[model samples]
Target: MWTNIQAKRPVWLAGAAIALAALAAYHNSFGGPFLFDDEQSILHNPSIRSFSTALTPPGGFGFTVSGRPLLNLSLALNYAVSGTEVWSYHALNLLIHVLAGLTLFGLVRRTLALPVLAGRFAGQELPAAFVIALLWTLHPLQTESVTYLIQRAESLMGLFYLLTLYGFVRAATAASARGWQVATVAACALGMACKEVMVTAPVVAVLYDRTFLAGSFRAAWERRRGLHAGLFATWLPLAWLVATAGGDRGGTFVLTPEAFAGYWLTQFEAVARYLQLALWPSPLVFEYGVTPVTAWTQVLPYAVPVVAAAGATLWALRFRPVAGFLGAAFFLILAPTSLLPGITQTIVEHRMYLPLAAVIALVAGAVMAALGRRVWPVLLVLALVAGGLTARRNADYQDEFRLWQDTVTKRPTSAKAQNNLGRVHFLRGELPEARQRYELAVSLDPGSAQTRYNLGLVLDATGQPEAAIAQYAEAVRILPYFAQARLRTASALLRLGRPAEAVAPAVEATRLLVEPAEAYFTLGQAQAMLGRPAEAAESYRAAVKHDPAQAEARLNLGIMLAQAGELAGAREQLGEAARLRPQLPEAHANLGIVLAESGRLPEAVASFQRALELRPDYAAAHYNLGNTLLRLGRVEEARGHFTAAVKAAPDFEAAREMLERLR
Candidate 1:
């Protein structure tokens, strides 16, 4: 019994080492701020605010959680534990990545221990699988999926993908395969809900069975037809998700034939780059923005090598099935993203989250074959190198400024990187530097509506209203549905005091904005400035309806109602406005005016005093307090307030007249 337990020690030790390596490599990443798409997927995602909403996910496409309900639900769970502290989100992401690494270790060890391959890997299975799993887990290329919080979608899907295959392997050797088969199908379905990439797992599972267990496709299918059927049925939910998403995968995919051709051409270069990074793992980029390879000349050089590899993979499928499986897995896992035309990013490193395992396994297998049992030193060096590089990569994510700066330094031409760096600068209140970066971003990608809008915001904040309006107008021209740009354009026009010119963009903004309370409020201000009282009141009411806590909107609506002789309505709006914004002198002053008009003299005096406390020099508050006091027959107090109001505002004719009458 002691000997038997001792025999299992190495396997248990290898699993613990892989988990420890994952935790050590990502130790610094817990403090990494939410970057880029994390803003929409985890930080501001209303769907993840509750379990029910998260299970439904959001309707929009560009967000990470758009149609990925399982991914959203995971985020919701993290939120329940730690809201937006960010550490909890990073912890969950690292946990998912570590789980995937252990699953890969199990799958590789089990596959190598099978009868077909066991002869070559008999005593080396544990060591070889440990090296592959450790290197893959600590790979610098994985930092994007592990450190960048929103890409939890990638790592989480990868976990389920690995589990599906690992479950199948367990089922092949188990006496009762029913439970393992069900678990495999369940994992596949959950993976589909995490990301669209899991669509290839079923095919990969059948290929694994043919290569390692059954020795032929016919036998594999005959033996496990029910299991394969269950696996394929998992695709049904993915099909429904893609169908409901309009097959575009949330604006990331483009289906035009021309787009498909261009994207396919670009993949040759992208695949070649991924292979290079797999070996060297240096200069791992965070964002490789869309660079369409329309001309064949740009793709031909990379295409030659990639095409040769594909031909080699096809050749190996007929002769050397193990090599073929590894090659096929790499290509198959990436085929969905490579074939699909994703407009957001043409080449991203995170797509290698699972494919890296295939690459590492293939390379490690080659080393073990060449060196036999002497491959230990080489594997150890590789593991140490990969772990050190991953730790260094995680250091870049510690500061948002540093992360985007690193991307900008590496990919100077990536306009999206430049725009993000500018956003970090903007958030830090470094206006001049932010403006400079945004201008460079706009110059790099003039057609980018987001970059144009960002530049307009910098210009608007710097008091260049006309220039800001021009940028906003250009953004709207590029993307007509950009409500923020339209709203900014109207805001710039309002700043320039061209209320008539602001009206058009403000109206368009109200139509296009999702939460249009701000747009409605902007339109109300424009209408009021244009002397359209009824239109202004309608716009203010709409703003209040969309966002009941909009104190400024309620205050404006109250003033409008009081002017139109609707005292009761004015009193309600003004009271709520004051309650919502206790420090706003305007809200309390307006409420006091309506109270006096409604014959609430004592309440009116108290409101006026509170407004004066917030703003001692508020001429209007002093004047109103004086009027309310005079109505209460407190003539001495009324005289003192009138005198103070006249002193505060020399142009206050009404206060001066009241003071003279009291004297």
Candidate 2:
């Protein structure tokens, strides 16, 4: 019934349907808050703060944008336009998805219309391609790439990947193939910049050439050697980016033979799980984590079938090239992430972003072949169902709390999920809930430094300084470069008044943290607590050097300077502290002491008055004001302040002595 209607429709109409379906599926996702990697890649990424450094993403941080300069630059564009509003990022993600869908539609339609397969698809290419594109775009499994924000690295690369193939198909068929070939290379290069997954694109392009255009690899290479060369050349930039990005994509890659073997052994189950989700799309997890199946017995059941399918794909390359291309493309697209051991993530749905295309194409072709003219209604129903599921999945991403909660519910054993959920609770000020979650996460993954640090935060917030320090110490012991943990350990020690213990961690924190002002300030406090005035003053000076606006550090520096007989330096720091924190009475009181010692009696009186104005009952300020007044020969005023000082502090022996002498 609908075959007749679909046959009458042009490709643009089909594209419009795909676009509308994508929009409907993700309309609720525009308001979705940034989650997980988004915080590092988008929110805190200084590289995205300016266009000048857009191509030079922050490295050594394992950020999502670390090695993907194009992804980082794209985020910079979003940052320039909207800062951290998040809606702009989501909008760009949807645009990339829609563009990818349209590209897929064009690629499929044109591929079907090729002379080789035209006899079978004939007039139904538009509808068949539309079904594939629409279903793939609306698949609930894609919510991770579309709705999770930072995973734009996946969808953006997927777009360029499709364009590369689409452009190649056009180049093969066009009368003047030069422009299409260049566009194909450009797309491939851009894809490489988007993600390492694009390394498979060049291989996939060659495979497509062999399957559809050229009869064999030798013929395809001979005919389009230049195009293939250009495609492979793009790998140079990708290689350089990866190498310069700490050669490990920010420590995600684990290249040891044992790690590789374990990760590879786990891929059989991961691939099976991906296929299951592609078919069922239920209980989609945000993060599967980096747990590897070291024992072959655990994955043996999946390994047998997966190995068989791989062997069958190899065999089919000679006899059934088209079927082999689809199978190989799926496996090849997944091979980089699957074969390479990424210590950060093992099984993620977003890794299936492009590979899902091959799966859909295979399934759609089989369904179309089976149902023929009756396939239109079935495809339409599937598209609607997929769209509804996608929308429902996107709802889980509306807030970090909901997303992590959903992930924890689905993957109860995932320590990463529990940690992220605890982070959400921590941010919301739900200390008890956050503490419970963090404790569970720590117990689940005792070796996770990040979880340990997070548990420390919850412990510290709940007033358990010793426990917090223990967790922080464990975190730094595990990941020595963890600057924040080092700083937190020192802070917790200082909280317990263990200045000697705090000094070493505080000093290490100063060396490890990028912004070490807080560490230096904490170190100054520790030094002052231990009666090391000179060292304390130097630390405070270093803190002020890093952050000139730190009022507390300035106040501490002033006190140290005054005690060390640097009256002029003390006065300057105290004045700046008062300016920086006008509401702080301590700043004014310290400045008064420095001024009095500097022989500026009038200024000292005014400073004491300012301190008393901010805090009328400040005992120290009253006593200091009394001393300054007495020096200025204002005996009655001095007597009144001495009385007020004694009232503010009944145990003020110095004020009582002065009062008695005055009497």
What's the true lDDT of residue 104 in model 2? 93
lDDT of each: 0.89, 0.89
Superposed by TM-score, candidate 2 places the C-alpha of residue 168 at a distance from the truth, in angstroms, of: 2.0
Would you list the clashing residue pairs of candidate 2?
none
TM-score per candidate? 0.93, 0.88
Q: Quick one: how many clashes does candidate 2 have?
A: 0
* lDDT score for candidate 2 against the true structure: 0.89
lDDT of 2 by residue, 461-580 (tens): 989999998899898887787888988988888889899999998999898665689999999999999999999999999999988999999999999888889888888899999999
- Deviation in Å, model 1, residue 178 alpha carbon: 1.1
lDDT of 1 by residue, 1-663 (tens): 999989999988998999998888888889988889888677767778778788877655457887789999999999999999898998989889989999999998888888888678757888888888998999999999999988988999999999999999998899998999899999999999999999999999999999989999999999999999999998899999877756666556778998888788889989999999999987888987777776889999899989998998898877989999999999999999999888778889999999999999998888886687788887878888888889999999999999899999999989899999999999999989999999898888888888899998888898898998888989888778788899998888888899999999999988866568999999999999999989999999999998899999999999999999999999999999999999999999988999998999999999999999999988999999999998999999998888889889999999999988876
Candidate 1 matches the true fold with a TM-score of 0.93
Count residue pairs with overlapping backbones in model 1. Answer: 1
